[model samples]
Target: MAPGKLVLATHNPGKVVELAELLGPHGLEVVSAGSLGLPEPDETETTFIGNARLKALAAATASGLPAISDDSGLCVDGLGGAPGIYSARWAGPGKDFAVAMARVNDELGDKSRTAHFICALCVAWPDGHSEVVEGRVDGTLVWPPRGGNGFGYDPMFLMDGQAQTYGEMTRAEKEADNHRARAFRQLVALLPARPA
Candidate 1:
């Protein structure tokens, strides 16, 4: 059965809002760790799944509730996936994504702009039971950025066939095919069916 209440292991308001919207229809009430005054744990894991599992497990253990966490990033093929795990760190202390985008543009000068966004999600229970899923969306990078709808690298990521960057798309448009949405769908499928 779906948990009546689930803690989302994150301090990002955008993620909390997006996740809440994605999971709401499943009959779950979502709460963020930040809302409960839970401390953020250091993400020492090297892989996306590992980080997600770490965060989810920490929140579940602390709050005594089932928890979900997502670790997502943009990886550039030409850059050999550097900044993969360090995607957020690229934004620096103030979470300045504008600086991050500039760095990406600087690095890719005159080179292949192929890239992809990846999302790994983990759901953990207080007793240690856990499930993980991953999803990705292939795309190319754009210069000068675009729109202001999405957070992070969305302004520069244009999906394979879409003319608009993720930042230019409406919430519904982006959610329709985003890596996070794909991962969340897989997670929902893996969740135990709600009792009748």
Candidate 2:
């Protein structure tokens, strides 16, 4: 039987909101570990899936509930996928995404603008069972970042064949076919359906 409720192992309000939206149609009650006073585990893993599993396992064990976690980042082809796991770190302690975006622009310096956003999702049960999936959206980098809607590097990322950056798109538009949404869809497919 599918779980009636699951814990989302994250503290980011944006992620909580987005994940809740994704999980809602599944009929699962989503609660964040942060709301339950669960400590945020350090992401020691190098890969996105590894980090996601680490977080999911930590939350599942600590809360005695099934937990889902995601680790996502932007990878610039010119930079050799640098700032992959360090995407958040690039924002530094204050989470200054502007500075991070600037760094990305400076690093590129007229090189290949190809880039992509990657998301890894992991669902872990208290009993140690877990499943993981990854999704990516290919795109190119843009300078003089545009719009002010989305967060992180959204303003600078223009998906292939799209004119507007993610930051310029409405939430509904961006959520459609996004990396996180794709990963979540895959995860949802693997979940057992709720008993009617």
Candidate 3:
């Protein structure tokens, strides 16, 4: 069956709002996992797809509704992807992106700042059906964080050709090229259109 107003397994306001804005236009009513009272599950998986699928499947089973979940993090080439799936906990809870970004830079220290923001999204149905899609945006991580338009590592994440970091870009611009949006588009592509 086609998806009918599925829940996105996340409570992040920024993430949820953006997904809502993007999916709303397509007539896909997006619901947050918080709205459905589903708790965040432990991301014991090693890969982005594993974590994303874990949350999506858990939410789908808990709510009995189709669910989608995304896991994304900065993967620094020089640091050998030090923070891959551990981006959030890099700073040790409190979800401190500042400290996390700093640690990432320190780890790279004088080396190349080349990195990519990878997003993995998974959609799951209560009947045990699931699909995963992923996207990435290559960029350089700067020493001092810049811009106030975005949260997390946005201030430090500078796109190759762009002069500004993700935080420096306007919301519309970030939404257009963000890893999550990129992955979401791919997930949408894999989805079958509504039935007549």
How many times do residue backbones clash in model 1? 0
- Model 3 misplacement above 4 A: 1-3, 194-196
Model 1 lDDT, residue 41, Cα:
94
Every candidate's lDDT = 0.92, 0.90, 0.85
lDDT by residue (1-196, candidate 2, tens digit) is 2748899999988889888998888778999998999999999999999999999999999998888998999999999997898998999999999999999899989889899999999998888888999999999999899999878999999999898999999988999989999998888887675331
**lDDT per residue, candidate 1, 1-196, as tens digits?**
2748989999988899889999898888899999999999999999999999999999999999989999999999878896798999999999999999999999988888999999999999888989999999999999999999989999999999999999999989999989999999898888785321
Residue 82 displacement in candidate 3 (angstroms): 1.7
**What's the count of clashing pairs in each model shown?**
0, 0, 0
Residue 144 in model 1: shift from native, Å?
Answer: 0.6
- The C-alpha stretches of model 2 lying farther than 4 A from their native spots are 1-3, 193-196
| Model 3, span 27-109: residue lDDT tens | 66789999888899999999999999999999989988888888888898998886889887896768778888889878787
Please give the RMSD to the true structure for each candidate, in Å: 1.8, 1.9, 1.9
Rank list by TM-score? 1, 2, 3
The candidate scoring highest on lDDT is 1
Candidate 1 lDDT score relative to the true structure: 0.92
